[model samples]
Target: MAKRRKKRKFILRRVIVVACLLVVGFFFAIKVLDLFGEGNSKSEESVKEESVTKEGFIEKIAPYAQELGQAYGVKPSIILSQAILESDFGQSKLAKKYKNLFGVKAYGNAPKVSLDTKEFVDEKWITIKGEFRVYATWNESMDDHTKLFVEGVDWNPELYKEVFTSKDYKEAAKAVQDAGYATDPDYAEKLIHVIEQYHLDKYDS
Candidate 1:
């Protein structure tokens, strides 16, 4: 009888030990699953943040700029930087309402809207209401912008020819300014700053 009691007691102890191990393993597995879920949540949040930020604006325009750059021999960085500055990330009234991202002026009965614009003149800035071209889409505006470099102004067909022949983005920015693309004295510097700030030149190749 004593042996029988001893055997039963040993079996009970073994059963208890096995149960405890199982409980510990179950808790550990749950902890690992929780950690994995949290990691995925963090990754998803990062992606969402990227989509809503200024970098998002750059990404949206980069593909089009790269395509235009290849077709026109223009630097994508220069085009992107100009769009950002001129369109205010597509937030300007001209960009939002008219899809005119470059502040391009209309001439000879082309589609246009009169809007207030600021121009640097005589070592100062002045606000002038001017007629700007209207476009059906951002792509149209970007195409027209490229054509300005390729076709140049009415007075000089080669006015912006230097912009197309430049070796680098910095040179292109300077060339645009030298060719009088904008009246701002710091137009070239602003373009260079924006290009470096966002690593815009990565799309140049």
Candidate 2:
């Protein structure tokens, strides 16, 4: 009877150990599946968002970008990227209300609208009502953008001179930042990201 009792206890312990192992394995498998499922879900969400947003913006501007790029001897990709960034895929209030794709501000009381714009100043973003140029059409906006690079800002030819001469899209991006195209320190990086993400470089050709 003692031997039998001891054998029963041993078997019970073995069964308990096996049950715990099975439980652990089951939970681990569940956790792994959860992780993979979440990852895939997030990836699918990102792809969906990209597809929706990419369809409307550049497609409308590429013809103008290509033509102006050729006329001004600049990379079409850079021009398109600038428009995409400044205009928020041509959906920003400034772009919508004024058809301003490049965020070119108006001076000397030109036809313009005072829009609430954020500018990076003193290492922080400050809100200011800036005067932005209004365009009759998007093509006019693109034309004015090209003229800005060719004719320069404030009638000063020094600005964007390197950009006008750059042979590569990347170089033109750097030159744009160097010429103070935007107050954001990461302006070039953002442009490059837009350029690469949308394959805007194809227009550069």
Best-fitting candidate, scored by TM-score: 1
The lDDT values for all models are 0.93, 0.88
Candidate 2 residue-wise lDDT, 1-205, digit = tens: 9999999999999999999999999999999999999999999999998777766678877988898877778789998998889988888988888899899999886799988999999999999999999998889998888888888866687797898788788888999998988899999999999999889999877
Clashes found in each candidate (C-alpha, N, C closer than 3 A): 0, 0
- Expressed as tens digits, the lDDT of each residue in 1-205 for candidate 1 is 9999999999999999999999999999999999999999999998888657668788888999999988889899999999989998888999989999988999989999999999998999999999999999999999999999889888999998888888999999999999998999999999999999889999998
Q: How close is candidate 2 to the true structure, as a TM-score?
A: 0.74
Give me the runs in candidate 2 sitting further than 4 Å from their true place: 1-50
Cα-based TM-score, every candidate: 0.75, 0.74
Worst-scoring 10-residue span by lDDT in model 1: 48-57
Candidate 1 stretches greater than 4 Å from native: 1-51
